[model samples]
Target chain A: MTADRGRNRRTAALLISGGVLLALFLVSLTLGRYPVPLWDVVRILWHRFWALFGLSTPVVWTDAMEIAVISVRLPRVVMACLVGCSLSAAGATFQGVFRNPMASPDILGASSGAAFGAALAILLGCSARFVTIFAFLGAILTVALVFLISARAPGLRVVNLILAGIMVGSLFSAGTSYLKLVADPANQLPAITYWLLGSLSGTRLASILPAAIPMALGLVPLLLLRWRLNLLSLGDSEARALGVNTDLLRAVLILCATLVTAASISVSGVIGWVGLVIPHLSRKLVGSDNRALLPCSMLTGAAFLLLVDDVSRNLLATEIPIGILTAVIGAPFFIYLLLRKEKTL
Target chain B: MKKTIALLLAAMMLIALVGCTKTPNAPDAAGTRSFTDSVGRTVEVPNEITKVAISGPLAQIVVFALCPDRLVGIAQKWDKTAERFLATEYYQLPELGQLYGGKGEMNLETLLSSGAQVVIDVGEPKGSIREDLDALSEQTGIPFVHITATIGTMGEAYQKLGELLNMPEEAEALATYCDAQYARITEIAERVDKANLLYITGDKGLNVIARDSYHAEIIDLLGNNLAVVDSPSSKGTGNEVDMESLLLWDPDVILFAPDSVYASVGSDPLWSELKAIRNGTYYEVPMGPYNWMGFPPSVQRILGMLWMAKLLYPDAADYDLYAEAAAYFRLFYHCELSEADYDALVRNSVGKQ
Candidate 1:
């Protein structure tokens, strides 16, 4: 009877999560400058999925609507989903690894490092693509340096790691400040400022692929270790007694989280607030059991980001950067979460 | 593995050769150059500077005219916006961020990475910034050059920069053009009474130049009786004046920049009651390449003055105004004047009071 109940709960969770994602996807697709009817959107999605397989079936207006939906809106929505999922997953993993729920991706100096790379690239005439590449490289380098500097053994001490990240992040921030000071007032400064704010436009397939491949590689191992993550969350010594290789596990998770965070940042620039807030929300919804929490976090994050990005792009004739919009919405939500969590605790 | 080794060796040799070609030791204008800059400073600008970085928009324009490929960097802002306004073909050149403003504050690592031989700053040096500039120049082994921001300084700056880059003739012609325009404007203004002029933007005092400011110097050349508004120290904090002050200083003729409250007075309820609006003596400012009349301090503002003169005193001269407009655009902006770009420049040279 207990087994049956457990199966039923899992099934229900899966169904609800899938339903939320699908509903949010539909809403995102429909809410744009050129609003398509429900039937047209369904047809458009149908045509896009089929067309990819070299199938030649054309219902009237399917081609244009498909282009509008898939080419124009789909990449942005998909990117938001991917970035959101990765960031939240990384955040959850980091918080668990560190035994600190307050942890987020940028806390380890990754965003600051990426911002420095991007600022340098702009100063040197490199375009958005190179900016992403350099930023990812900087993030990877920063994480490596943080790990190296903070490691008491082969793995990191949580407090030491945080301290090293703060040190490195501040150094990079100083570099960025220097770049801003010397930049031309008439032209380059505004562009850098806008880029730093983080727009999701001008992201081509090429830019997306570099980030996506690394994320996929990182996420696979993570999904496999989801059960282990729950055990790991019960403090490091408890995790070790339960037959987990705690040091190896910590390193792997940190590397994976860094990969996911860096990949997302490369394509999307530095989007803040989502990673910090979504995992907490996931925890609230399904409790802090990593098994349910990880997947739920991903789902909630994907849906929330898509909803935010949709508002960002469609609310005005000129699209506000997703980073700014996310903060505007999420900061208040996060404060609310803290207030609610405080009452419960 | 052997082939890879050989290829790497070849690449290293090529890089060395490229490095050597960058430092051509050209002599300065005095012939027996003392290897010293102005302010009695000793600095080493490698003979032929292959890699250079510029700080200002006008400075970048000057450098581009001299050597298109030599610029290694600029302030980030130049790389984004103003470079787009340059003829489309020149957009593909390399840039470095504004490593320094008028004073040189560059990343030594970034400068070395780009292999810049000299640094060019395009404005007057601010306090303490000059010291930083000197320090950076010494540390980076890149000679720093400063260009002034005067009426005829663009030509001189360009020519000197061109000479440094082995493109003197182009720079000379540009300088001569600027000199002639300056001379002509001076000649024209000397004949008119410099007192009766009223400047406002739409219904507000967005900006005003008094007889003491640099803006006043340019307006003074227009040969008009300057009617000045008493701008308080608290108003617009030295950039603009209040609308109330503008109404109080109502004069015979009102000239306005684009989108100003002064221009809107003919239609504005508060301003329609003003004497200038009632007499139909309002004018809309001209728009030209780089916002000539809108921001009346660019070299293009000379064209604004000629247009203004034609409108205010139509009986004053028999100048071929369109020809002059066409010539100025052709010479400075390096484009054949479209009738629209020209008309837009002079159309509402000034608007309703």
Candidate 2:
């Protein structure tokens, strides 16, 4: 009866998440700078349904629709999904390893480090793709430093790790500030600022691929070890007693989380809220079982991001930064979390 | 605990008082301080303009044009070639950090350490900037002047700059020359029906100027019919029209720059679609120290307009293009163009790219 109850909850999560993604996909396809009719979108989707199975369609309207979907909306939606899932997965990994709910992808100074790297690349007048590579390197370097500095005892102390991250984050932030200082007032500085504000506007398929591969690799391992994450959540000693090598597990988890977080940040800029809120929502839905929570968080994060990105494109004549839109929606939810914390305390 | 609080409060009050104190003008040998500048304005200048700063390229350009000796700082580089060219001047002149979108967030300590005397800004006047400049003036006794661009109101703007710089005669000469050029361009432009002119560049992708822009106004002054007069977004200032919009608004006589339109469409793909391209009416605009054919109606632009009018309507004018170009430079820029320089300006066309 208990097993059946768990199965029912998982099925509900799957169905709800699947429905949200489908709705978001439709919204993304129809709503943009040039809005298309919902009926036309539906017609294209139905006609091109066979094309998905590698069969050619005679309808030319379907071809145009396909190009719009594949060329424009598809990459954007895929980017949103990849970024959202990666951030949430990394967030959950961080929260578990740190044994603190407040811990996020940025807690280890990944975002600031990436921002500094991006600024450096922009200042040098290199391609935007070079900025992504620099961001990844910065994130890894920051996390590595955080790990090295905080490795004082048998296991990593949560407070020490956070302090180290803050210090490193500030140092990297100073680097970003320095680049902004030296950058050309007319062109480079504004470009750097806009890039840092976190938008997915100027991404191409080639630029997206590097970030996607590492995130995919990191997420698979995270999903497979989701049950072990639940074990780790039951305090370090308890997790250790359950035949889990806590130190080794933590090392692997940190590496995966950093890689995935770095991958997402390098591609789409630093998008917040998904990492912090999605895991908490997943826990509320699936009763803190990492097995169910991880997949649920991934889906919810993807759907949430796609919806926000859809709003970003259509709501304003100019493409509004997805990061700004997410924060506007997420801040209220975060306030609720804080209020709930007050009641619990 | 009460004593400690009192001590902290006292320290805070002391700091606040220090901040509130008026910056003292240094006394002269006679012990009477007469705070005045070369402009003859009785304005106080601090003993030091330490933390000397500038905002945009225009700010640096104004300093270079007016008082190159007074400049203690500069901003970041854009083009690598431009950077190499400007490096000697840049190394000699310290940069006061990057100005964020002309929003000068000066590193106060770095600026102060440098012992800068004045901060010169050249761009659109911002509110917070005025406040900061006022505060810095009160705090450090450094004078800040916003030099206006001599684009729209050329003669008046140049005179105002002269009044600020204490160069009244040079200013009058500049203003007179600018006025003559403006009148000449308008008189010549009046004779032609507004021809469909597309000002595109080969360097950047699909970014074109509209009639509302400062650049467009110059083209309008030259008496040309703008292809895409309507812009996409009427946001902050200028509108960046997209590629699809360009296709919809077909132009007659295309005057494209080298760097802007050269990337995407080489050898003119729209040969059949465009009247200008098909008839070979498309002409590459001349680019030198200043891009002539690209409209934004500066003092240097008169030369470009003359060249463009001569190229597009050779029968319309019997004036010598070379002599006109040289005269315009001498009259406005206050520098004589050498024979080679005049040839370079004339030969430097959009077709060269």
Candidate 3:
């Protein structure tokens, strides 16, 4: 009876979180630098939704309004959802796999690699699209390098992998710093700085699908394998004793998480706190159980980032970098949640 | 505990009160004369002024134009493109870094060893100008003074710069020349109807110099700059907006930064949706040594205004662009403008890049 109640409560929590995410998504789509009325935001989304199904309604809204909501705002809203969901889910997966409370999505040098790649691209005066491509390549390469080094090391596999990650990540960070030093101060330096401090201000409908497809690829497997993440957390010896290939499972999970992280960061740049903080916040709300935690983290992160991006685009005429807002806003909220948890204790 | 606390509080108040009354301005020494600067800070400057240091690139440009020989060091190293336009001695000065924003701070060791008598800061006054200059002056033991140099008032800046540098006749000639050019630009600006224009920058051509920004002084003066955002970015990259916003803005004339998507914007299908792109009204800003439009906002923009004027309204400009370019190159850059160099500089600017 107690187990059934626990399951029911978890289901209830998921439904509520999903509802909140949906509501935030709509809110985010409405809010932007361009003033589109609330009603028009609905009308544009509604008209575009039916148009996708070949039901062309009578056009009442202006092209600018349609373009603002559908072309400009929709992609940004979607990018936020993709980045937030990927980071949170990946972060949770890393924590569970490593059995480390401090592990984040960039635990394997993905973010630093992305940063170095982005800085180099900016230094080369590459277009925004190429910058994203270079960043994605950088992330994948660094993580692969980490795996290669860790594979041959003579320590505990997870420990060696983490140490290798630290070394590689630091080297990439140093590379990013060097690029910044050498970049043209007039234009390239600011572009690189803005890229380092993540933003969704550059998101376009055309760029969205490329990033989203890879993010979906990584996220779908993460959801399917979340039940097994719990087994890995119970120690590799115990999981192996129970007849699971712990090494293979760990490798697949890490790759999936890395892919999602790289794709999200390449598009949105390096948004920090969502990956590191959201899963912990989700764990507080749900539990440490990966089955409940992963979905919860994804939903909460999507909502959190969507909310932050809304404020980022709408709060000022200039874009306050999304990464900055995440920490500035998230730290206080996290502290509040922790305090509430402490009070309950 | 209350007695000890009261004693500590009393001591702290005493320190604060003493600090408030302590005048940072030192009384005039024998060799220095008091000069009232733009921000109304009376600074004791050397009477026989020779070596001058600049605070940043903006100051470097104006100072170089006025007294190129006196500058102790360049704030930023001139690019290789400047080699043909500027003498090696001027462009190859030891870089003193900068006092304010950019990659590096002012190298004190370099400045001290270079034997600069006074450091002069010119450009728009940031909020903490007086305090910052005074603090630098105190720290370096070299008098620091600020002279306000705006896009509209650099002519007057030349006169003030002349006073500080003790070169009134040369300052007068340059000042009069600047005043004439600015007045002509303003007259030409008033003669034409403002076109809906967008100045786009960044490698992607997604950023816009918003209306009322310092960078958009010429754009706003000449045309209706449409990229009005809530908080305009002060950085040279401007505000980063997507292509959709560009389409929504739908400017009649689009000016691309020299470093931006001028070379490839024509090929993109998404960009081709914009009326400016479709109409082929987009053009790159001219650059040789520096962007004619204000990035660091130096005296070179005197030519930028004329180019923009002629580009926007040919009839009202009422002056030969090549004639103006040749004269500006001779006076400011100290390089002769061959017809070919002028053509090359403005080749893409006149039409599509």
- The candidate scoring highest on lDDT is 3
Each model's chain A TM-score: 0.91, 0.90, 0.97
> Which is the better candidate, 1 or 3, if ranked by lDDT?
3
lDDT of 2 by residue, B52-83 (tens): 45655555543454444456666533223233
Native-to-model Cα distance after best TM-score fit, residue B65 in candidate 2, in Å: 24
Instruction: List per-model TM-scores for chain B.
Output: 0.70, 0.67, 0.87
DockQ of each: 0.02, 0.02, 0.02
State candidate 3's TM-score.
Answer: 0.54
Model 2: per-residue Cα lDDT over A1-345, one tens digit each: 988988797879878987888787767777654334577667666655755764433332422233445445556777888898889888878988787888888889999999988888767655555677888898889889988888963454767778889998999999998777656444566767876767665344445677788998899999888888888888878988888998788788888889999999887777888899888877766656778888888888888888887776556334567788778888898777667743210
Give me candidate 1's TM-score against the actual structure.
0.54
Assess each prediction's global lDDT (C-alpha) against the native.
Answer: 0.64, 0.64, 0.82
lDDT of 3 by residue, B26-100 (tens): 222346888989999998888888889887778888888888888878877886778888988887887766653
Residue-wise lDDT of candidate 3 within A49-136, one digit each (tens)? 8768654444555444555677567877898998999999999999999999889999999999999998887776565667889999
At residue B57, give the lDDT of candidate 3.
Answer: 77
